[model samples]
Target: MNDVESPIDLRNLKDALEWQETANVKRPWRKDFFDYYVDLIRPRSSDQCQILELGSGPGFLTQHLLSQLPNIEYTAFDFSAVMHQLAQEKLHASEKTRATYVVGSFKDAHWQNTLSQKYDFIIIHQALHELRHKRYAIEFHKTIRSLLKPNGCYLVCDHLCAPHAMQNDQLYMNKQEHLQALQQAAFKQIKIPLEIQGLCLFEMNVI
Candidate 1:
């Protein structure tokens, strides 16, 4: 069903599930990425850490994050209506979990302004390159730095697509570009051998 006639149809709930089902084999990458983040971010002496996961489709990565940091709170957000609904259903099943799901376009959402809370960690998985503006990524990076505590961390992971394939109008940030943006936003990149959903990890701290 995901291989529908139109791209719009592929964005539907059924297609989203189908796509996820097909991509299930890639969970190892996602797992590795999250593990790297958890290890690096090991919140020091904090009992109530918070995480903001961007593009939290179906809450797969979000669930793992929550399990790792049992006392931590989570705010999972996604742009797609179908994925947002799925995230709500998935997150709602947890009775004791302190997780919130928001349905809004990540491209231009007032997440920090509306929430008014800083996070110990912010994770962006398989979602960076989808942004249409490189400046947006930079702005978002700056936003994260501003919203993170002095010792807080941010993790961004995305597919290592063929270099040539990133030539489209939409600015798909390269690995170096990502690092530069993070650094410009006053973040320090920490090298780690991490992978997730075919993405390599770029962990940074807002020191």
Candidate 2:
């Protein structure tokens, strides 16, 4: 697949909602991905962990996480206001209290400044490639690393471009390139907890 601009404008409410429905139907494995995240986070369920989700989209994962981990404080950061609205609508009144919605594009250098506090877990699922190009991966990973608290983990799952099922190199990288970016960002430890279909998930820590 070649690099192409997104056809749907997530900033539009109708488009955002349509995208949410389509994605859920087209990708059955998304539920599996969500469950995997919940399993990884289950270990920290007792603590009041701070979780930041980059490109949180329509809050499918946010709803899953908040419902599964009651004590976590979540910040859903996305660039589109309509996406934020859609996410908020999915959440209950109580979940809304525990979750904060922030609108900012990670493509901008100053995006990190919008967040006041560091997070125990920074997550991005099927969203990192929204940076629009692979060249920006390393610097973005560095920025994500800086936002993490001591002993915090960055959990990222994104599409990969590989020999068997190649994607646009400008938009997606292979597994090795993904690991290299995390390592170059100075993550002391990194592990690949999952890799299925076209997606790979990395669990990274600085300590």
lDDT of 1 by residue, 1-207 (tens): 111122433248888887567655745555666676667655542678878887777767776666666677888767666875665565444523588776665556665664557788888887776565566677788777777776787878776544543443344556667677777776765664674333667878765
Indicate which candidate wins on TM-score: 2
User: Candidate 1, TM-score vs. the true structure?
Assistant: 0.79
Best by lDDT: 2
> How much is the lDDT of residue 60 in candidate 1?
75
Give lDDT per model, in order. Answer: 0.66, 0.88
Give the alpha carbon lDDT tens digit for every residue of 1-207 in model 2.
344587778898889888988987866888888898888778976878999999999999999999888899999999999898888888888999999999999988789999999998999999988988888888999898789999888998998898755568888889889988888888757898887777788998768
Q: Model 2 segments beyond 4 Å from truth?
A: 1-4, 163-166
lDDT score of residue 84 within candidate 1: 59
Off by over 4 Å in 1: 1-11, 41-46, 91-96, 109-111, 161-171, 189-192, 195-198
> How close to the true structure is residue 49 of candidate 2, measured as C-alpha lDDT?
90
The CA lDDT at 68 in model 1 is 66
